[model samples]
Target: MDRNLIVTMNAGSSSLRCAVFERGSDSPDPLLRLSLRGLPEAMIWERKDERSGESLEEELTPPKVDSDAQAVALAEMKDRLLAEVASERIAAFSHRVVHGGRDHTAPVIATEEVMTDLDALSPLAPSHQPHNLAVIRDLSSGFPGIPQVACFDTSFHRDLAQVDRVFALPRDLSEEGIVRYGFHGLSYDHVATALDDLAPELSGGRVVVAHLGHGVSMCALRNGISVATTMGMTALDGLPMGRRPGSLDPGVVLYLIEERGMAPAQVREMLYDRCGLLGLSGISSDMNVLIQSDAPEAREAVEFFVYRCQREIGSLTAALGGIDALVLTGGLGEHVPDIRARICGGLGWLGVEIDHGANDAGETRISAPEARVPVFMIPTDEESVLARDAETVLED
Candidate 1:
């Protein structure tokens, strides 16, 4: 068996991303990548050979696939991999679990009891937790004896000051695990480690990393550790995202229930799938689409997103006592120049200045020469982090 091979899986609501890495003594080299997205008519499967940088895209016929989405997708992925390489090469399966609750503050082997306890925490991360667990369970059932390590997204923030993790509620409720536990930690951890190589001088200084994607959140890093973050309690509590309404006033929720007579389920649906940029623009949840649109509503949505990001940057800056460097990662953070420029424009007073030419050119360091605080665009490597963690757990 190729014991050095590790498979890392990231299960989303409608898609699954998996990567294969060949681990060596130094670091792992990525082998292949796969993404499966469920569509109305059929499933769209995409695969990339990192070695050759060649990609293949195809649609899976429904008649040949199982009705269960997770089962069919995993089966198809297995078939494709076996066709290219032997199954014995796969050493272990690593999963990106969204919530680790209060106790699972590190990666652990997914035993039956562990899975049951993790499944119980799904209500806290309705959109993500279930899907993540589904993949882990499926792999466990399929591979049987092969170890599956659950690397939690919340584990990175386990060291948050008790004051930061506390809630303004009854002590009983607070002690019942109803406290701030940030998400997107795997992504943030990748960025945190990359900072030293990306900008050595600023790596040890105060840095705020913005992981903006369909699920958006910002983290404040002091000396490469999470001191504060935008996400709290759940993924939905962070900055406004593709569909989630972020940082909503609790009274609005009470009003929806007591005054409007809306059920909790309906309110939950609205908050998780009907709000954010989609609700604001009545357009696409995609930032690219919103940026290209001339509609005033679209402009307003984009403006509001930028405004919120700017506000959070200020808050994180306060948490750090000051700002030294700002690093943007993830889809929207790395690619959308206009959004980054807009977010940084309002922060010029804090010695933040973007080099328009470099920013537009998509350079790694986009800060102006005279700018006191440097800005960087670093792509996150969550799968690599998962693979490394899984390997470590397996070795242990």
Candidate 2:
């Protein structure tokens, strides 16, 4: 209700996080600082303990998650967020929308038609779009007077070279929204800003940013510009994640549809739900679990994840012309020492040497002292980015 407060929301497929930000005391710059943060229903699907040994699939339970239950879940997620920010008068609400289609490249105030346009992109991000719009719909109606902003994840790739943004298909298909649009952009931008703040020299260098979590991707940045990324077109098209299958053969998808007689819905469900670590391990999707499992599938899952990361790093390095540093961010990137080491192993040709002791201890700098390319563990702060965007966009 006042000039000092705003709400920032990051709505993922299974989880939604929110933060409240308030202006500094009489700061004429119109800048904002974080106030509070919360993650309501993170990993709503039932998950086996990651630390648990492999061959424990029986412990899995339906997390009581319904695929189409976005409306109610969003209402509850927002209610909890509002309760968390109860003391502050929220001036505006901001969200992390995965796809902005083509027009928007910056945070923009959401209008009725804008919501409709974004909704049309559900096919592009079936696992993410509905829940994203659901949060906006419920929250917008709930707080009629508060302004809502859609901060796009795809916006960051708008400046990507045309070669990196388009497909080799016909012009009509390429123009029909079937081009490359990268995701996890909000987190990557935060990585760039964090690096600039704490390690200025490294931020401008050829940097490969690994954003590993339940869902994962890698981006190659030269001076904070995205030259290439692992994910393209859809979030499902990246490195293998918890339940999402990333980068599979197009023929496999067709075989499942045409030969196996799998309906589109069933195929989508398998790709978005049953695949990845879960399908690969025949156990759980949780990284901690796969790391602990003694089963061969579990080992394969971990190996597959790290191996692809290495392969992608090479591709990203080629895009950057060379890598000067590597940043491991997001949930998995911050704490998983072995995973980070495994990924960097194949990159030895690129002159990246890891300090096992530092990495194992979760040190911010994981590279050896003599290593040419610096490796950092910077925890991404998307809420802070959203808060900054909210303040910037809502200012008079």
Candidate 3:
């Protein structure tokens, strides 16, 4: 238990988010958060104080041109942050891995064999797994003897029913781990636990949480356990994301390959890098930008995003048999009030009503007093969950 600092990392394809937490018995105390983004070209590093909300951002000197350089930059940044800390002992380095396949339903120590197995599952999560592992490998080599843990984003949905996990494929295929393993479990886990303190009534009731950031997904929870979720097999299977197509017909891929003579890699790049808000609007992939533009394409993209979210709410509502509450979290879910309004507009049948003023003010409870289902806006903290898991595994 002498490990002084707990480093929690969530590495994406384009960004690496890290938080340093002071070791504690229950929940670790947040010390500082560092975000390094734009790894491909010019890397931008941002440092924020967890308690005071103070922030500072600067460009990475020499700029990380590729993943290797990015790893080095991260290592250097970590060392700099450690120097600021009074202790040199790092207890553990925890990661937010996107998929755990089937075997890893919980956090596990990331040994060499574990990293190899996770690397094999990279194709299943092209955007996250590789980068996540890269950081792990980097840290492992740089700081020998430090404990590392991998917390799967899919681990939260391990309790989903068999029917919910199946893909209507042959039983043999399902047995081979080709089932609908949901993503964003880490975010959902945070929200689920946070609800007890934030809204006890809705926390114990049937709740559907929508995590709508650059990556979007929804989950249905009964008594704070995952019942069903929108994402399946891969992150690309659910609600449209910042760049992902989301829930496309399988036949579309066949058409692109057979009729249009497209390569699988080409299609993958298009789907993962150039679709959704960007493809639909022919504009930037960021929702903030799309929301501000007055162009018709921008409007169409925003409308389509809202439409898909509305449909997902209905699907998840059916899964829960009814809706007691709806919670929104993530970049767009928390910051953009108009998107939230548009999503709640068509759910009047479910007795969902938004208080315009409350919604705009970013209040916790945005639903009207008389509404049957109360909607809440809560920020998600996946890093905190990962940190606690690291503490548990290390302690155990």
lDDT of each: 0.88, 0.79, 0.88
lDDT score of residue 86 within candidate 1? 61
* Model 3, span 210-256: residue lDDT tens: 99999999999999999999999989988998999899999999999
Which tens-of-lDDT digit does each residue in 1-396 have in candidate 1?
Answer: 556678889987767788888867454547888888853236788989877889999887742443666667667767776676666777889999999998799999999889988999999999889888888887788788678899999999999998888888999998998999998999999998889877777888899999998899999998899999889998888689989889999999999999999999999999999999999999988899999999999999999999999999999999999989999988898889998899999999889999999999999899999999999989888998999899889878
Candidate 1: lDDT over CA atoms? 0.88
Candidate 3 regions exceeding 4 Å error are 25-29, 38-42, 59-69
**TM-score of each predicted structure versus truth:** 0.95, 0.88, 0.95
The runs of at least 3 residues in candidate 1 whose Cα sits more than 4 Å from the true structure, single-residue gaps closed, are: 25-27, 38-43, 59-71
lDDT of 2: 0.79
Please give the lDDT score at residue 5 for candidate 2.
73
Can you list the residue pairs that collide in candidate 3? Answer: none
Please report, as a residue range, the 10-residue window in candidate 3 with the lowest summed lDDT.
61-70
Better model by TM-score: candidate 1 vs candidate 2: 1
Where model 2 places Cα greater than 4 Å from the true spot, the runs are 25-88
